[model samples]
Target: MSETTHAGNGISTEQAGVEQELVDTVLASFDKAEDPRLMEVMQALTRHLHNFLREVRLTEAEWNTGIDFLTAAGHITDDKRQEFVLLSDVLGASMQTIAMNNQAYKGATEATVFGPFFLEDAPEIPLGGDIAGAAAGQPCWVEGTVTDTSGNPVPGARIEVWEADEDGFYDVQYSDSRIAGRAHLFTAEDGSYAFWGLTPTPYPIPHDGPVGKMLKAVGRSPIRASHLHFMVTAEGLRPLVTHIFVEGDPQIEIGDSVFGVKNSLIKKFETQPVGTPTPDGRDVHSQSWARTRFDIVLAPGSDLR
Candidate 1:
């Protein structure tokens, strides 16, 4: 008979001995994977998963609850709602992956989680146009330039922006077919772009799902800091998907639900009085308006596949 050993959880030697054998068995099953990357990933995933279970001494009830939670998360996901991504964000996994993929490039904008609400083929708005649609919110003017890491302009770059209304709800939140606070536009000759948006306001992430329940169970809030989402792309440079956080937002200091905020992305939103001239040559009619500038620097190099 093999020598006996006891785990921290008092798991018997026979049980702990079978654990490594189990991991080895699972890894061996992936030996026939056609892709080498697939085999490597499977082996690593098996090792990590086994290690996690062994370290935590997970119980059957807890494992069942996790499975149920994931099942519910998938059940609620659809065209407009992505509960899985929300789950990943709250787990800090998404941010960790982003940090790993986006190595530091001098002058290049730091990347963050691409929250679940970004829509493809968002309405295209011309320069100096308004993207707020009919959404109710304080008007905000957003202007910026797209440049390479070396400070050279990236002409004709595509800049996409989206945000929630002052009510902290995105256009997709509504059942009706209304588009608000989302648009895309191209940078002008000198790599400049301008558009009207809404003053960012802190809002809770969609908490009507499994992720919400998990947060509640863990005594965590589901609130995300106020910010506007941006995805900038240009020829011969890596795409930048990021957000500009509103400076002084109480939520900023407290911590974002998804851990997405960065010091460099914080910008002051200046409040302008009525009758102030807008950058696009339009007059501000509201009692007060806000403006912000967010210049983006893209890293040189294309995505390798």
Candidate 2:
């Protein structure tokens, strides 16, 4: 690289010659975008990307490697598996976006990442019914109430729940079945709900693709703390996407791979002796059961369109 100096500017003209021209041309191409927001975003993105390349003095080999990695990520993605989300999560971009979008409300449940495993049209179950569906794990009784910021019950709220089994595998992970540990139900008149589920256990995030290779290269673990996923919504409130983490899970202190754990969302799972009667009138006979209560508070707002 030869340096060409500008007498008045006191800077190397070569550094700005080709780089600035490319950036200006790219940014100018977006000037005719019909949507104002699209134009603004493209302009900002182009400038930032060009600035990054200049700062790093990126080599052609390195840039090609990045393109190849992203191509691999896209090729691995499908209807059930999302490699791009895993890539965003490991890079911290997903968590940063979640934090920016979810400002804290007075009494609303804190929001977290909606992991890639959530299935559309999960089976609907009656309140107090079991969602385990032949999955193997310690039986647990989960009960809760839904209330607004003003402390009034929000009846008929839809609650969607899902989790992994004791062996740390979601229903989608199994080749033979895809219906365990997931259900949706509505709150009763008093905003109370209950269901049978498994005690959450620490599990590794899916890690056999590009994201996993990246983690290995960076010496980061792929574990996520034990937690039950929840998505709650009502007639006129901001929807809550969160999880109730198991209090004593060792992975919690290490931090979740997806960055979804919140201190306010942690809850204790108490062990009940065998032969104990449950709130829903089921008796624990051969195996002891675990129990926990998690009440939800929704932020008062217009429904999401």
Worst 10 residues of 1 by lDDT: 1-10
- lDDT (Cα, tens digit) per residue for candidate 2, span 249-305: 889999899888889999999988887788877865678999999999998775322
**Candidate 1 global lDDT:** 0.91
Could you tell me the lDDT of residue 164 within candidate 2?
A: 93
Note the residue pairs that clash in candidate 1. none
- Regions of candidate 1 where Cα sits further than 4 Å from its true position: 1-3, 302-305
Query: How does each model score on TM-score?
Result: 0.96, 0.93
Predicted candidate 1 versus true structure: per-residue lDDT over 1-305, tens digit per residue? 34566655666788777887888898899999999998998899989998998899889999999899999998999999999999999999999988888877887899999999999999999998999999888899888899998999999999889999999999999999799999999999999999999999999999999999999989999999999999998878988889999999999878899999999999999998888877766766656899999989999875532
Best by TM-score: 1
User: Model-by-model lDDT, in order?
Assistant: 0.91, 0.89
Question: Model 1 compared with the native: what TM-score?
Answer: 0.96
